[model samples]
Target: MSSRNSHSVLDLQSLTREQVGRIFSIADGYAGSDVSRLATKGCGKTGALLFFEASTRTRLSFETACARLGVHPLRLDGKAGTSLEKGETLEDTVLNVAAMNPDFLVIRCGDDLDLAALSSQVSMPILNAGWGKKGHPTQALLDAYTVRKYLGTCEKQKILIVGDVRHSRVAASHFELAKVLGYEVALCGPAEFLPEKPSVPVFSSLQEGLSWATVAMALRVQLERHETSYSLKDYRAAYGFTVENLKKLSAKALIMHPGPINQGTEMDSEVLQDPRCKVLPQVTSGVLIRQALIQLNCLEETL
Candidate 1:
């Protein structure tokens, strides 16, 4: 593996499919293992987790992952003295943090921001916790890791990603990585929510995509990112995975959500508890995958 500074894992594009596979393998080892003892491997290193947007899972997962890997975590949420609050540029904030000489930086920002550009300004490895509407590479890695753990492999598996495609970082990241990993990917949502020239197959109806999917990945409706108004009732009637649509899924099909799930909007309330739902497993895989990522990026220069 390259030195952490030589290659930052800000997006899946920077990682080959082989590298990603290796990451999942490492994550697999961490799963169900005594992570507390494992934390000692990264002792003396520090990671800065700066989130410019509101987050629950992504922020907490990264902090927990850092702790489990024995890397001290410095957290900064969407509050006072951040770039926006202080009216300073993101580049400046990152450069300031770089000066502090943290081993790595994990950042989550609005989808509109360019995290890649921000990474370019820092010498230490930068891990994109989540980036505005464009990417959530780590989440994609964990999601893929979860799928592989349950289904044996990801190659050629049909995955239908539903909802808020135009604004979801997770959807964008998953779409890019899944295509690279040879998963048959399809998008389902309203025309406004779907991208005009998406690389993957775009379905007008959720039922059509669901029927073809081996994995139904539901994305939360990102109202915060919406430009125009949307009706909840209408959205649920059309795009949401209603109880009726839930029954349409194959018994073998797996269900997943990136979470902070808007129950009754993108999915039915009961679907959260469904036997086939792998939501909790996705959360578990997230911590392990992030730990693996931190371990890889926090390696000493001599190593």
Candidate 2:
């Protein structure tokens, strides 16, 4: 553990397998602890959250997590009069905010910006909420937490991650984390949208991948600020997980999505609400996992 100013979660790959295991243990402890006691334990003294991109879940969960720990959360979303609107560079903004000496700074930026470059400019601990198409470490933590909660442990659990790997930060981190946690991982998407030679097996069709997986995690099709001339219907037909395709999953298999789910594009809305779906649990785990992260970082400093 380290002070909020002394730590940064840039990517899941930066964390060792042991550290990931410990994070889960801490998250479990936090999840099981008395809610009333959590605030008094070490609540509001930690730090703030800085997000440079649009977010509903991660931003709010981090704020709630800091509040539970009795720490103040200074939220920085781009708005009128924010330095960002003044055309100031991200480096300058981060440096200026770092000078305020907050306990932690959590950032979600769109460009898949250089995290190490940003980290170098700020002394405060940095956590990547989402960084371009690179990674989302905290999301990976919560995803792992969700899997462990339902499936007992990730060891040897067959997992399939489907959809646009070419543009998903969550997918990339989830794939890497699943592998590190000892799950047999597979990926499926259109040939143009898949990663180049991933460590795990890769498939071009959902039906083919579904045969081998005990869990299927789908990533939403990202339609960011840019509108491409791509065909949504074509993408849906080829890569989307429809109700028919959902039935192909193992009876014991779980369905997951790192959401703002595109109802008719990447997944069927009906499938999202399926009994075997763990999407809601993934959202719940985000708060607890973040709380555990803040607590563990503080504990490290004390040790």
Best by lDDT: 1
TM-scores of the models, in the order given = 0.94, 0.91
Local distance difference test, per candidate? Answer: 0.82, 0.78
Instruction: List candidate 1 segments past 4 Å from native.
Output: 1-3, 81-84, 111-113, 300-303
Please give, for residues 1-303, the per-residue lDDT of candidate 2 as tens digits.
323444677777667778887788888888888877777756435565667778998999998888787778787886456877879877677778878877777888877457778777766677888888788889878988888898888888888888777788887787778767877778888665677667778976788888888889888765562246567798777677788877778878788887888889988888867888998999999999888787776434621
Clashes of 1: 5
Point out the worst 10-residue segment of candidate 2 by lDDT.
294-303
- CA RMSD (A), model 2: 2.5
Q: Which stretches of candidate 2 lie over 4 Å from their true place?
A: 1-6, 43-46, 223-228
